[model samples]
Target: MTDTGWTTERMPDMTEKTVVVTGANSGLGYEVTRALARKGATVVMACRRTNHAKTVKGRILTEVPDATLDVRELDLADRESIRSFAENFEADYDNLHVLCNNAGVMAIPRRETEDGYEMQFGVNHLGHFALTGLLFDRLLETPGETRVVTQSSGVHERGDINFEDLHGEQEYDKWDAYAQSKLANVLFAYELDRRLDEAGIDNVLSLACHPGYASTNLQRRGPEQEGSRIRLWMMRLANAVFAQSAERGALPMLYAATGEDVMGGEYVGPGGLMNMRGLPEIQPSSDRSYDEQMADRLWEISSDLTGVTYDFAQAKAADDD
Candidate 1:
């Protein structure tokens, strides 16, 4: 369970900023897109399924009245799709204030993504990894303010990367794999923040956020080995008591995107009932998560796998001289 204390007290006015949010067809992503659009940001909703994103556009306009919503086609799980989306998006927009890596899949049964990596890890971690790398320049060109928000999960609290079996190739435990991906999310955020700071880049922040136990479709898609009524009943009962609505779940990410007092690399989450529901606040990470060696190793491994090294060394030199 989470024990962080965070709430949405300070939200910035993003009148001319352009924000791109992935997986904005439903749930927390949808809420984030609408909220940003309401605040006068030209919000681009990128989803795998254009039809679904179009539907969300209609729904959001209904609520936001004059919402500036643009739905784009993107499939994060596929490298080709990611490249296409990035190229197309770049051809249109000159500067982007926010890039929300909010798309992901939960612990599905043993399966492979379009790229052959474990589904959970591939979609949840690697997919976003590539997407962010592709859009790195766009984010850097924000001129004044640029924020990248990664939607981590509380399960990251119980995550550890298994390099020996990173892809879950030897053996697969859906929950453990999911945990690893979430943990990767945090490490990726921290690593990005460190790199940015070393590069002397200011007004651009990378943050990690979790919604705690929000009542979303994520739980229903988790590892279901057998159809056990007892487990199902227990989940329903727990969810009924602990889970918050999608709006509340979207707070930590939104806070990270717009909160005035937040520092880069800080983990943000809900601040109530073991982090199940509440406003956004600063949070602590597990001790193991602070291992610089592990983070570096993971970074090297990710770069090798995705062929998308961030090249912070060059960025630092550029920032300095």
Candidate 2:
């Protein structure tokens, strides 16, 4: 099977499979959760706000009467919350087929997470890194081929990892921080795939995708948090005029999750002009995103910062036995 002419309609049956999507309360995350639930996958909506997650879950149930959904609190801005969510999930579920690292904070003003890391980099990149590491065993031990789909953005092209300023301590530009986080996401996904292959793990696939200019609340939150009405309004206007709907924006992720044609280490995005809006297909990202040395360094720093490291050797041994 090739990525050519792929659509959600071609997604195979997902009955009995389990998927976890972070930031599943709204935007692209919500759309992905809904589609997976409709396809008979047991979907867990991992989010920070319990109340908001409940509302989204209710809406999904209304749309798909039989949708199997669970709303779990997962505040990516806090490391403790990430650990707790992963522990609870593993205790309750025997297998996990998909782990979608979809939640993120956009170009918000300078802030710090509960652990004191820069907000954008902490929440968008390190947060997901920890969560994936914590639950990697479950994914590897699952019945069939499992996937880890990390979401990146087009803005990553302009991103560069400032090792000295990973936390933006010396200086901070909101957009620059956000771009770095997105680049980290892409680098992490690709490195993970390479590591998985090196460990001789064939059943687990890691991929990355971007929603080309998707209309989502990600743009509003930064301004709303800063209490800038003008910024919020501008974002809304831009979304209305230039962005595609959340459902369409979520296609690349959905395809990465369910498309048999997709492979580990591949990047998927909209097939339209400049990858802004169209069907999902295999796409190329920024040249810098493919830097193996940078990815290795980032992974090391992430493990040290988050105190969560992936032991692929152990995973491989388990598979061997």
Clashes of 2: 0
Model 1 residue 40 lDDT score:
78
How do the predictions measure up, each by TM-score?
0.92, 0.98
How well is each residue in 84-176 modelled by candidate 1, as lDDT tens digits?
A: 999999999998888999988877677787878888888888888888888887787657768889998989888999999998889998889
Error of 2 at 151 (Å): 0.5
How large is the C-alpha RMSD of every model relative to the true structure?
2.5, 1.5
Residue 312 Cα positional deviation in candidate 2, in Å, after optimal superposition: 1.1
Root-mean-square deviation of candidate 1: 2.5
Give the clashing pairs for model 1.
6-279, 6-280, 6-281, 7-280
Cα lDDT tens digits, model 2, 177-232, are 99999999999999999999999999999999999999998999899989999999
Error of 1 at 262 (Å): 1.0
The whole-model lDDT of each prediction reads 0.83, 0.94
